[model samples]
Target: MNKKIGLWDLVFMNVSALFGIRWIAKSTASSFGLGLGAIPAWFIFAFIFFVPASLICAELASTYPRDGGLYEWVKEAYGEKSGFMVSWLNWTSKLFWYSSFLTFLMVNVAYVLGKPELAGNKIFVLVCSLVIFWVLSAISTKGMSFAKIFTNIGALGSTVPTILLIAMAFIAVIAFGYKPASTYTVSTLMPKLNMDSLVAISAVMFGLSGAETTANFVTEMDKPEVTFPKAIMISAALVAGLYVLGSIAITMIVPTDQITASEGVLVALDQVAVALGIGHWFIRIVAFGIALSVFGAIILYIASPIKMLFGSVKKGVFSDSFTKVNDHNIPVKAVYLQAIIVSAILLITTLLPSVDAIYNVLVTMTALTALFPYVLLFKSYIKLRKTRPNEKRPYEMSKNNGKAIAIANMVLIVCIIGIVCSAAPVMPSLGENIWYEVQMIGGGLIVIFAGLLIWKRFTKRTGFKESS
Candidate 1:
C-alpha cells in the first residue's frame, strides 16, 4: 500500500535486520567453536544454509510481491494452515528476540554509564527494557517514512561502529604487535561435524541471517522483483564480510573464555581501546553506537512481521478493527499489540534465575523458534516450483541444471538440524541450569502450537473454510 520502500530502503532494511555485527560477538561466544575456530562455520553454513535460503526468499517475494510476502508465498503453495503456522513462528521468534536485544541494549547502556555490572540489576534492566521497547514501538507506529529514518540509522549505526572496531583491531595487531589468541589453519578453520559443531552452526541461523525476511516489505517496494533480490545478495555479502572481519577483530583482542555471549562486543571494544592507548571515551562512543544499532534492529523486527501478520485481519480471519492503520498508513493496532505481547514476555522472563539467565533463556528460545518457520520457507520454495511452473520468477534458480533443487534440499536439512539442535542447549555455560533449556524448548513449542487453536478459531469465526 505504501510504496515508500524503494531499493535503498530495502537495502537498509536488510542492513537493519541482517547486518548485525553485534552477532559477531554473539556467534564467537556461542558453541560455533572456540575463537577463530568459528570462522569455518560461516562458510559452511553460508553455502549449505544461507545461500539457498536467500535464493528461496528472493524468488518467493518476487513471484508473490504481495502485502504479506512470505505468508502469501507459503499459502499459494500449501494453503492457509501452512502459511499461518510459519508466519506465527516468525512473529513469535521476533517477540522473544526483541526482549533479548532490549537486554543487549540495556547492558550496553550500563557499560556506557561505567557500571557494566548494572546489567544484572533487575529493576534497571526491566525498566530500561520496557522503556526502550515502548519508545521504539511507538515511533514505529508512524509507518514507513519514520521507520525508514531508524533503518537508515540502523545502517549507519551498525556499520560505522563495526568498521571502527575492525580498524582498531588491525591497529592493535600491527602497531601494538598484538598476536591474535587463535591461529587459522585448516585444522582450526575446517569444521568438525560433531553435535557441538552442529549446535554452533545454528548460530549462523541467528547471525548473518534475516536477509530473506526483506520479502516482508515486498509490497511496499517500488520495483520489488528487481530490487528485492539484488538487495538481498548485496546486503548479505556486506553483512557476511563485516561479520567475519569483525570476528577477526574481536578475537584478536579477547580470548575465547573472556568473550561473554551477551555483551562481549562491548567488552572487546573496551579492551581494544585500552590496548591501543586510546582513552576510555572511545568505549563510551561505541557503546552509544551499539545502543542505536540495537534499537535500529529492534525497530525493524517489531514493524515488519506484525504488518505481515495483519494480513490475517484483511482476510476476515482477524477482526477488521485490528487492521486499522494510522494516518501514516502504518498498522497502528498491530504495533501496539506486539508491544503488549513483548511486555508480557519480558514479565515472564523475570521468573528466570538471574538477569544473565533471563537474557540467555529468552535469546535461546528466540533462536529456537525462528528455525521452524525457516524450514517452512525452504519447503515452500520446492512446493512453489511444482505448483506454479510459469510464475514469472525474476530470481529463479535454473532448476533445469538439476543442481538447484539438490542445494535447496540441503538448505532444508540445515534448517531441520538447527531446529533439532535447538532442542538441546546451544550454550554449555547454561548446562548447570538445565531448566533454562527445558523452558526454552518446552516454552517455545507451547507458543507455536497454540497458534493452531487461534488460527482455527479465526477461520471458524469468519465461517470461512480454507480451500483444500
Candidate 2:
C-alpha cells in the first residue's frame, strides 16, 4: 500500500480531522450551563474520555492498521453485522456533524460580515450553510491531491484562534487586570456529580474524543507503531490544552451567560479585538480562518469514509445507483445523499429559538449519533485483546493487562454516560423543546434502522447472503 503519511502528516491529519476552534466557546458555555466549573470540567473530561480513548485507539490501530478503521476492526472482532452497524454510524454521524459544523461556520461568517442578526435569520443561515456544504461537496467529488495543504491550514485554523484567545486572556489580565465572572473557588471548580452539572458530557466528549476518526488513514503512516502513538500523544495533548485554555480564554473575556454556543469564540475575539484596538477587522480575519479550518475538515471527511463505504457496497447487495460514481470515482450519489440529509437537518435545527440553542442542540445530537460507534470501538478493543491474546500487536497498551482492562471498562462507562447526556435534556428548558429532542433521538434511530433496512432490501434484491 502507498505510504505517503509521516509523523507531522499524522499530527496534521489527527488535529484537523478531530475538530476546529468552535468548541472553545461551546465547551465553556456548556460547562457553565451545568453549574460546574469550566476548568475542572475540561480536566475531568480529558481524564475520563480523551486520554483513555486516544490510548485505546493507538493500541487498536497498531493492532489492526487496515484502511477500514472501525468497520474492519469491529467486523473482525465481532461479525459482519456489527461491522456494518459501525460503518453506518460512522457515515450517518457525519450527516448531523456536518450540520453543526456548517452552522458554526455560518455563525462566524455573520460576524465577519458585521451582521450578527444574520445568524438569527434562519433563511440566511440555511442558504449560506447549504451553499458552502454543496461547494465542498463538489470539491470532494474530485481528487484532493493537494490534501496536505488542507490539513496544514486546518491545523493552523483550529489552533491559531485558540492561541489568540489565550494571548488575549493574558493581555487583559496584565493590562486591565481582568477578573473572571465565575470565580474558581474549590467548591465551584469541583464537579457536582449530578446530571445537570455534567449534561454537556457529550459536548466535552464531542470536543475531546475524536482522534480515532483518523485511524482509518493509519495505513498510510510509515511506522504505525511509533508514529501513531507519538502523533496521538502530541495532538491529543495540544487539542486538550486548546479546549481548556480556550475555554478559560472565553470566560476570562466574555461572561458565560452571554456566550452563545456558535458565536462565543467569535464574540470573545471581537471583544478582545476592540479592547486591543484592532476592531472588526480581526473578527473578519479569524472568521475566515475558522471557516477555512472547518472547510479543511469538510474536505477531509467528505473525501474519506463515504467514498470508502460506497466502495464496499459495490461488492455487496447494493444497486449500482447507490454506488454510482462520476469521472472522479467519487460516489457522486452518496455525496448528494449526504448533502440532502444534512440540509434537512440544517433546516429543522435552524428553527430553534436562538442561534446558541441551535448550535448546542446540534452539537448534542451529533455527539449522540457519532458516539454510538465508539462504544463498539472500545468493546471491540477489549474483546479482541481477550479473544486474540497472541495476535501480533505492533503496539500494545502499557504492560499491565489488569490495568488495561480497568481503563477500558472505565472508558466504556464514560462513553455510555456521555451519549446519554447528549441525548437527554442537559438543562431544564431543554425539555420544553421535547419535540426537538424527540426528533433528535428519532432521527438517530431512523439513520441506524435505515442502514439495516437498506441491507435487508439489498439482500433480497441481490441475493447477498447475510453470512457474507
lDDT of 1 by residue, 54-80 (tens): 767776776677766567777788888
List model 2 lDDT by residue over 225-310, tens digit each: 67777887777676667777777788878877677777888888888777777867878889888887777777877756777676
> Against the hidden reference, what TM-scores do the models get?
0.86, 0.90
Q: Which regions of candidate 1 are displaced past 4 Å? A: 1-16, 30-34, 138-144, 190-197, 214-236, 299-301, 312-314, 325-336, 390-392, 426-434
Model 1: per-residue Cα lDDT at residue 127: 89
Give me the displacement of residue 422 in model 1, in angstroms: 2.0
Q: Flag clash pairs in model 2.
A: none
Candidate 2 regions exceeding 4 Å error are 1-13, 30-36, 146-148, 192-197, 213-231, 426-431, 462-468
lDDT of each: 0.72, 0.74
Top candidate by lDDT: 2
